[model samples]
Target: MLDANLKQQLQGLLTNLREPIELVSSLGDDAKSVELASLLDDIAALSDKVSVTRADDDARRPSFLIRRASDAQVAVRFAGIPMGHEFTSLVLALLQVGGHPPKVAPEVLEQVAALDGDYHFETYFSLSCQNCPDIVQALNLMSVVNPRITHTAIDGGLFQAEVEDRKIMAVPTIFLNGETFGQGRMELEQILAKLDSGAEAKAAEKIAAKDAFDVLVVGGGPAGAAAAIYAARKGIRVGLAAERFGGQVLDTMGIENFISVQHTEGPKLVAQLEQHVKDYDVDIMNLQRAEKLIPAKTEGGLHEVKLASGASLKARTVILSTGARWRQLGVPGEDEYRNKGVAYCPHCDGPLYKGKRVAVIGGGNSGVEAAIDLAGLVAHVTLIEFDSELRADAVLQRKLASLPNVKIITSALTTEVLGDGEKVMGLSYKDRNKDELHQIELEGVFVQIGLVPNTEWLKDSVTLSRHGEIEVDHRGETSQAGIFAAGDCTTVPYKQIVIAMGEGSKAALSAFDYMIRLPADVEAEAA
Candidate 1:
């Protein structure tokens, strides 16, 4: 049932519809279908501009077709219930079909409007995937801007056969022109760039020439962006090579601890980060991944950073800020129920499990924090840790313990994810001390084990910790003379954005100091 506040908000938004819209449901006699139909009925009852109708089952069941009454060519479809975070996608799709332009940057809209050729985007997603809606909405907006482009959002749970046929292992996987286009969250500009320039051809063209800079910052997260900005302020040539500019920040949801701002989202923060970096005289290279690091041949000589795109860049100093990704449990049924109910990000998917029971694996700072956060939204939270004691800070642990709805179980190792082939139903764990296996029924499972640093490409070039984190000193200097490391990829104690930004500044300063100490000839070449 929709909350009163949400219903009021929907009513206000729907009243602005310029054209009448029809919702055709091809639902079966299932619980999900009945619930979705009721939700649609409530939405239709809100505005005179909206109407609902039953459709033949010749198409996929549990599906919906949203179209404008004035346009017969409108064929936007939602393959499953648009609950959870996906509800936003449905709202935006309705607005677009009702003759409303999406709220996009003017430049982005111009680029989208100028696009030629028929581009079909088939985006597969789960309701729990927070990053999925951004991509889905972006593609839908593109379709609205140009008739040559059309997009369809497919729910992975309802379309199991299609997901299996495509061998899709993750949510928010997009297929463009009948081939896999991209995975996870992506910016509208990046998506347009990929479509404009054929992926392979673009890579070859960008890699054809070797660029040189005074400082090369790898990774485009907060750390790398800060490093590039700080170094660029020194009036030296700076280059940034990154697979995607925001790194793990793209996966994050609500961020309240980022200082000044009271609240913000991952995509919003990323847009600001990119805009700030662009404000500097930095050569930003997006979608370029560093494949290898070649150390300088001599002291104070230029070092080479090889990219996965076949391009290489030579720089006098380099700052390694390649971030980390969430660690996953290699247990059975874990992969199968990825987006169905097994989630990695609590902020992104927590609301989906509202009033439902869920379990969080691990007891570290991240895990306990997730548990505390989820407790507010979920009906019950079971926090399981392999260690006897929780590894979170005393304050966080205290806060977690205060939650009446949260249950903390120590010395428990997650064994397997229990699911019904389509969605997670529960989880199995073993008592490490007693060696007894037990199962707990829940709708969602959040894995907050830890993070894995993205430093595989730097193993041969820099010193690394046993866990693959780059080893760095207080000044963020790595073992290599002219190279520095920062952020979650380094030996930094914390993985917060502010800490990474500060470390990036330190790395840039350290690189600048190193360059100043170089011989006159080398410094001149660097400049």
Candidate 2:
């Protein structure tokens, strides 16, 4: 029996599907097969079809896509590729197709539904991660009310070339317009703000009003700083724009895995990175958002970047080196226990929990990897997962199984984080299979579930995969001319810091090539 939350989530997924979808199954005549056939029959009956008859292709057209629906008709989504956690997405897609109004409050929906212009959405995801479902569904819901908005979900695994070209290193990235607005699973209000024409237009105007630079780089994490350093080294007048100076890397305790750095704290590493960029001539715009991007008017011209403060920068080229961030459990006590003993990054904070009992939430590669890593340092490691089976690669699963101190608790939902004033102490959970409740005494919890890309601001500007990941060429050229993106924001394969730095360098070089080839007048003015 499925839980109510799971059932509702599944039903909402069915509504996301576009119309005229039929279930085709190959059946065999056997007792077990007959039972399966009966269930399939019932499912077929449950599917709702959105009709669109074509007058021109009345005889030869495929029934799946007929005529476009009129203004008031509900848009249905197509559900396919049901695998692992993605199976949940398949259900949500059906819900979108069925035209279910979002669970968002009426006032919020009304505010969002009032939009009239086009919204182009692209999301990038790696199937190996487990959090892409929520991000994908949120975008699907945004598309339901705003018919002008079209969404595309691109799988980084299948489209390696595209992902590498875009410099994507994480899963569940969303891009609004031509800039990054937010990363990971965003709230409805955040999406709405990006979708709002008047608000975004004003934000864009403010961004365009800022001083100009030869190059503008967004994100101040490793990737952004790396891009800034490289660009400055080339003798270009570069400006780094970031809401926060260190980005997500500052939240970490320590980073020991970054190559060449034997042992270092996350904040220390980010400080060094920031100093390196500042050492050069790169101008840093801390605590500022890259609200929007406007392509130069002339051929091979400079680009204009708008910031949240109504300041804009004119640059010969732009490099996006925004990196990925860890996803949160969002359960009770999670927010309260953050830093007081809860963390999202194991690679950065695993060592801090050494000699202590810790719980790893998630069952995929990251989860398994964290558990395996923690097992070597921590006194005890309990792996909690909502699913019954581990979805990591076989090799990783074997390694996890080999660990003696690691206990795998499958089909468990962590409902509460039990902690004391200064730090964590224990946790409460329930098994999905049975009604039995359980508790685990632990000092720390590492959320290794997945990552979300920081690319929500680029929705209306470029062609993104359905998951809001920027689409780039092998050299990191976005769909829009004179604009480029890289690092974890693009569809890159690995989310490692090393990989992000490498891709950031690549994007900088690509942007350099673009800047060098630009018309002398535009280049000179920006320079």
Candidate 3:
């Protein structure tokens, strides 16, 4: 229950859009109806500025709350409040909106060409947190799997007033046909139940729950995708869900070293892998980030993959191939100038700094590699190292020294990033010895000091290293039963792409081994 004071505050907060206009229009001494008209206009404008652009004008009509396809009878979902822990909930909501039955089997997708149905789902979320990427991916997957399930996203922070009016509390809250369906992380079975009960609310919401699958891959990265292709060839039901269809590879600019592929770009490699998986009956879900892992209760019990979108999935086995993200400097201006001037992963955004002065922060291999790489493209490269000595390999150290334009500043630290509104123009630095301070003007700054794994969201659900990387055994098994961790986020010594892929495969097989001992009715209970 909301406190009275909080409720009044909420009322005031909500008034930012509608009631204020009515109050102002009242000065004209018009009838109540006239003031109501003014309020309606305000609501219309607010909705337009924040809601997803529908495919057609009629598609967004107020009467057409839920759009159903003739074949895939799925409920279109729109998550309006998605943020923080709610990011995973948004994915679950998308699954429900698409009318997918819990625990989808490979044979199920192959037999059904189109999942046509009409259902409407609305979700709310915030954009400030990095975890929201998973929710965005889940919604995207729903749209792709079943065209009937159109998705509309609402910015919770941008439209705080509107969200308050809707009485939204938790993020990733889903409302089906104007009624609260569920909150927090939801599973496929729970979502189907909501649809089953929402029919009288004016949408043709029906639950066509499918049979459970043999293997359910939770990520669509190089590791996850590779695993799916391998499993599918073996005639296993493999479903791939990821924040983006390409995983971390999407942000990568080039991939010169991938075997069997010569001089290929990152996106191109992802496209090829994606196409290969598409050729099979694999259920590939893009933009779906798994929030939680519900391990099988009995032998042969299907695993449950819940998303922030309020959608849930059931699988016999789970593979976590969710890759790591580029580390941030955690500096004040780094957040503000993220895409503007501050960047991570030299391979991703290094080209933007070409012919421009840039500073690479860190002395490790990444920092040294970035400095050497940027020296060829940028006018100058300033490598700042806090440590008295470089930590990179000696061979790379010589290569870095060979670059005439690259300057190494040891025993120095970045105090702050200096920049204007448009872009980063320069930065301030201080000597670790506290003897000197200097400022340098540069167009861009790349932080390669280190990487922070994406396992913080997993919390104590799995084993994490002291540095937060997931702890995996030789076979990629974590401390927790039936769960596995892999990639740069894991305790693997080498943070190489090949290594991450290998660990991912190991984790998949481990999950498969765990699943085979579960009960057959696990999907029904999980749903």
Candidate 4:
């Protein structure tokens, strides 16, 4: 079950195990169970400290638990084959359970250890989902850290009956104590905040007591990472506040156009970006949302940034790279049925709708690509476009046309997401050419329209374009003095990762220039 290269790598990693560990599997006679047993045997053969056992915690077949042989309390489990994106999760669980210390921050580890009450977390995930690995790994680590917490990462594709019973149409749906906790991507910090009520307030108090930074970068995308690193390299105090470290990049599927890098996935690139930024002395404020941006009362004065945590940070210069999010089709029932039938990620949720009819909205590259990807797993795909013709590249259009299970409809506007109050039943759309309204019965709706700038919070603070993007000059400087913006949140023509990194660097340089030219008295006072 394990390839030669993978076995070699796992052999090297397993040698780091400081203690013995056991793989307790509850499997059946199914093919997947046999495959899992083979994989477990391969793993046990890799290291002397590893062994396999039997356990019957649940009826789910082909599942196993990785526990310290000395103590079963410190354990984590996988309810399916932990391959694809979840392979890393499996490796981390093995290492962590085998007595190899995790690399998480000291404070985060303490928080996990301090968590009280019983936390039996069950997370549903798809193999292709880029966002699910983080959730699974986080919960797995938490379960290992605290005896009260137990996490089981279940594969939604393998257990269709449970998924249907729960009405889970999205990937990474989490349940705590048999009740819904959250859906979609969430960070460990965010999870702790929700579980530990005082976590937010304590974090806020710590942030409020910090000294004013020389540069405060808002947003944790590639642009924000670049800006923070550039500023920190100057030996200046830099603080970065963001909702999540990766921003929209976490949702992106595959990236091939990044310069120098031949090919990569969004989550992998984000991990690299975050690690590089951490190499510097920059202070990172994770899982923080900037609620408002206040300009300095004077030309060379401190600027204030209010956060949703009820904390504020002051900085001499502020760089905005909040980025953009997937644009929603603002139609009736769209909000009500979100995650019930309406989804924005094709790669993550496509597997859950196997052999089921689905609709893809938009005619751009993303839409065409989603249609192509879904045509293989789903029974049929209907591509709906508001444009008179497809706006995707000719190559993509040609490939989409060759698919037998795909049906394209141009000049169509999505009107309402038809649902039965519990789940999606179908959708209604308008034909622009014939002025006729039509409805299509589908089990799922994949939206790939485009992106909207995450500038709603800045609307009352800065000058925004008519389309709501932050307006900026050539140097990435915004309308406000000593304030700059970059990436998809700005009026930049292209929204590529490489371009965003370049713009972020330029914005950092511009901020440095602006600081140097400030009045001598102001500089001294700031210093």
* Cα-based TM-score, every candidate: 0.74, 0.50, 0.57, 0.99
**Residue lDDT tens for model 1, 311-338:** 6788888999999998999999988898
**Tens digits of per-residue lDDT for model 2, 46-94:** 4455332222321211111111233323332322223444455545554
User: Tens digit of lDDT per residue, candidate 3, span 262-323?
Assistant: 67655566768788889888977654557777676654455677675556777766666677
For candidate 4, write residues 421-494 as lDDT tens digits.
Answer: 99899999999999999999998999999999999999878899999999999999998999999898999898
The residue pairs in collision within model 4 are none
Clash pairs of candidate 1? none
Off by over 4 Å in 1: 1-130, 152-183, 188-197, 350-357, 372-380, 393-405, 418-426, 441-443, 524-527
Cα shift from native, residue 41, model 3 (Å)? 53
lDDT of 4 at 499: 89
For candidate 3, the lDDT comes to 0.60
Which lDDT values do the candidates have, in the order given? Answer: 0.85, 0.66, 0.60, 0.94
What is the alpha-carbon lDDT for the whole of candidate 4?
0.94
Candidate with better TM-score, 2 vs 4: 4
Worst-scoring 10-residue span by lDDT in model 1: 199-208
Clash totals for all models, in order?
0, 78, 57, 0
The top-ranked prediction according to TM-score is: 4
Span of 10 residues, lowest total lDDT, candidate 3: 18-27
Name the regions of candidate 4 deviating beyond 4 angstroms: 55-57
- Can you tell me which runs of candidate 2 are displaced by over 4 Å? 1-210, 251-265, 297-302, 330-342, 345-358, 364-381, 386-406, 411-445, 520-527
Error of 1 at 449 (Å): 1.3
Error of 3 at 173 (Å): 30
Candidate 1 TM-score to native: 0.74
Name the better of 3 and 4 by TM-score: 4
Ranking by TM-score: 4, 1, 3, 2
Point out the worst 10-residue segment of candidate 2 by lDDT: 58-67
